[model samples]
Target: MIERLISLWPARTGAAPIVPERSVAGRTLLLLITIMSFLSAVTLGGVVLMQKSAIAWSADVGREVTIQLRPVEGEVMDSNLRSAVSLAESTPGVASARALSIEESQKLLEPWLGSGLDLTAIEIPRLVVVQLSDPAEADIEGLQRNLGAVKGASLDTHAAWRQQLNTMAGTIVFSGLMVLVLIGAATVLAIIFATRGAMATNREIVDVLHYIGASNRFIAGEFQGRFLSIGLQGGLLGAVMALVFFALIGTAAGSMLPSEAGAQVGVLFGRFALGWSGLFGILAVVPVIAALTAITSRTTVRRFLSETS
Candidate 1:
């Protein structure tokens, strides 16, 4: 039965079935790279956004300053708080200064402490939240010296928040860059592997072409043409899929975020709008990787044939 099957597999002359060319094109490789690159790009883009949002939130929350009054641990804190408020209101670059009410202090602590916690017995420190017209214009060092004039008062303008924002943004952008680099490397490797496989499988055809006067350049061009199709198919598919995913997720998130935050996201989307850079990257990188793979395989095959013949 095995011998009969083997005999039947041979193409018959004058009635031979037209065998389609053995190709490395089509949805197999294209679809695989398309799905993988799309997912990876979307994930990296989200990481980039998350980092931006974190830094923005930190900056927004700490943009205002706070003044705390401790009246020698026994004296009335209200007198000292009033003095600090008077000082802040008269100071340069200071926009508004208001003493925190009992209710407000409890509101600040409600996230960590339960809603029903008694506050009357506790000697809560008096806090004055200070806003500025422009944070950059606010002389923080000068404000600290002014606060020194007020008895039993200390000023905090969130010096630590700036440092943390820098750290967080750097970490996130660095990670996104690393991921982009890895994706490029993986794409090149995949192309090289697939091209080599196709070359090996078509070794007989390659020898026939060479014998029929096909130059090395012609053979390499043929392979490059096929690989170019695969690269383009994968790249366009990946880019479109990534855009769709980003839009859907961003739309959903916009509805869930607070109005201010939502506005910020919209601004961010506009700022990060896709441009020629992304287009150039896909077109230039994919084709180059494919062409490189094709040329490398052709060189190896030609060298081997020359050595043996």
Candidate 2:
């Protein structure tokens, strides 16, 4: 099976001996895997960082809840609004609460409702924005009961939204972790397969070396050196390709998102520069994978030769 794959690329194997028979297709495949692995790591790490940012943003502003009040069929709207504000101020777990001014409410709603819409002409429900000393310290049900006592006032908090956001963050974190695991697995698999094939192809060379009294360690070292070189080459090529791909993606994404989000994406991309940990990881893992390949190949080849002899 391996021989057939090598044979498919006749030019690769039939090259002049002086030129050295580097498996171009094999190396290219390794390069592809390397690039994909690195890109996956960088992308997944970015996702984790983005999720952290989103969580912090939510935690910072999640404490506030708005209660809306308006006139019932017979009640006065202004009286109901004032009563709701008073109830909010008196409520426990409430740090500060106030009725939003007409202008303030208009400003908040302006994004969804265009400027042309006359907010004052329509009978809009009066809103009281409440801030809590501790987001979770408030007994929301108790607060709701108190607010319900006020005429035409309804208590509302982002409890459901917060729960959904938490779920999303968890999902993002899990997805990022999965991506890293897959990248590691792919790198290992690629190295294993490439080394196995290279070993099988060079079986005659290895046998001759064994006949000439080359120790197993020496024979392994030669293969190890070749595999290591392949790994290093593949890794460097992959890093470059990943960088270029990231640049293109960043440009495209930046154009689509608003300035703030676009800036965040830029920041994420900038952080993709190979940090010390990343550098150490690639260098260490690639060489270790190569060495593993060499050892596995040598052992398998020795067993095969012995059995055949």
Runs in model 1 with CA error above 4 Å? 1-26, 58-62, 254-309
Worst ten-residue run, lDDT, model 1?
16-25
Q: Per-residue CA lDDT of candidate 1, range 1-309, in tens?
A: 433443454555753211113344334566666765675556555555656566666666566889988647556677777878888877777788999988898788889987989988987777998887667777767878988877778988776876787777788778877887777667656665665566666677666666656666566666666666665666567766777776676676577778887777665553333345443443444444445444554565455446545
Q: Tell me, by TM-score, which candidate is best.
A: 1
Q: 1-309, model 2: which lDDT tens digit per residue?
A: 333443353454544321124667466655655675466545544664557555665675587888988657788877777777777777778888888887887877888887767777777777988888887667667778877767778877877877887887788878877876777667666655665566667666666556656655555555555555665565555555555665566567667778887777655444334445444544454444445444554565444546545
Q: Look at candidate 1 and tell me the lDDT of residue 278.
A: 42
Candidate 2 error regions (>4 Å): 1-30, 107-114, 181-186, 212-309
- Candidate 2, lDDT over the whole model: 0.63
Instruction: Give candidate 2's TM-score.
Output: 0.65
Clashes of each: 0, 0
TM-score of each: 0.73, 0.65
